[model samples]
Target: MSDATSRKVKRFSESDRNSEFDAATQKALEEIDVCQNEIDSINEKSSEEILKIEQKYNRLRKPFYEKRNNLISNIPNFWITAIMNHPDLSALLDETEEDCLHHLTKLEVEEFDDIKSGYWIKFYFEENPYFENSVITKEYHLDSATPTSESTQIIWKEGCSLAQNVEANKPGKKRRHEPAKTFFSWFNDNVDPYTDDIAEIIKDDLWLNPLQYYLVPDVEGDGENGVDAEEVSSSEDDEEREGGEEESRNQRK
Candidate 1:
């Protein structure tokens, strides 16, 4: 036998129950793998527990969500004002999206650091009968193009699947605002008709399902959701200046 084999055989102790019938190195490695499997099993159990907790949490929040939905139905321009309050999102939107915003029950945003993989936005609905598909998801691939603003931004990493799809299927000689052959464009044109030919069938369907209401809206509106840092700073500065002026006036009086 080889010297290595001789060493393994010498290391294996028949008297030691831990060694069993295997070599010392083999026994140690096998036990480590067994511990790792236990760890993995416990991790899976934790994941299951988290999912159960989330389901219960949703069930508890459903009543409040429905109550808010009812209030929104009664109060005109409720959602409109909410959307306009956010400076960044307001810039991207116009008056044309009023009707579409009404039926938009829920929007979920999942951000990924891997720019190549990009971000996923899932729109959930209560009763959208016009479209056969209930769920509409859009994936925006990160691009390395120059940002319009001078501030540092997380520009998308290019050459991913999202970019490739857009490049491969771009419409020939399209105008600046003209719709391209992207999945988002298709969703906007086919499902979300902002023009005169609006589909009431989907709206009526959504009206009956009270459980589809959402408490919090998505921050990312078509990828531009957050207000600029400068705007926030300016607002704070104005508030501070007003407070200081009021204090000085009170002292003089």
Candidate 2:
């Protein structure tokens, strides 16, 4: 068993009561422990089986993901537009990085052979005024209890660093209003990798289903079917409520 699955078990204390009742309580507790161990064993086995299934499907889905990327490449600014459409991702971005992201030619998520080990998120950019690097990548290593990540350091073209520009714009003294975090600033933030909110959003949400975000109606004008931005948001909210209800129903089942 993995160390993650074989940690020390929580021991139960006997109840303080008459000797006979205490003994009975202790015996019942022991029985409960045995049942719990059995449950854990099943859970461990289930996780192994699920990982195998995920690995198998990962290989199967590789070509489709590649094809999607190729198709997306043909659409001008598809990725940048999609990124701007996503609620969480859009929040991270500001006017400072908007032009920089326009040069983003491709974005890719590559899972390791052992999917549980970790994955890499790669951003490919055309030669632009902002940075020299053609490709910037963030790698997550998930071998231990706490996951750690490393990102490619961007070599900015002289005087064109968007992150630095944002910092420089901030007032020397504390202001009542703080400047919004630029998306590029995320590269330098030393956040916990395992629970990094942006990483989680990208991997589990955006990477899996970018089309949903991409299709979101632009608030600036009427979108497809004449739906407005507010309508799109409302639709999403309704879907979320329905999804939650369905999950609750499944749990009850």
lDDT of each: 0.44, 0.77
Model 1 per-residue lDDT tens digits across residues 1-253: 4454444444543345664455666667555555666676789899878767756765666577567666666654444455444332344343434344444555444434432334444555444323334456654444444211011111222421122233332334232343333322333332212320111212232223322332335544433257665677788999999999999999999
Per-residue lDDT of 127-206 in model 2, one digit per residue for the tens?
A: 89899999999888898886677778889999887764434433242322333366776654434564467777788888
**TM-scores for every predicted model:** 0.34, 0.73
**Model 1 residue 95 CA deviation in Å:** 5.6
Superpose all Cα atoms of candidate 2 onto the true structure and report the RMSD in Å to 1 decimal: 13.9
lDDT score, candidate 2, position 146: 68
Clashing pairs in 1: 142-156, 143-156
Predictions: Cα RMSD each: 16.3, 13.9
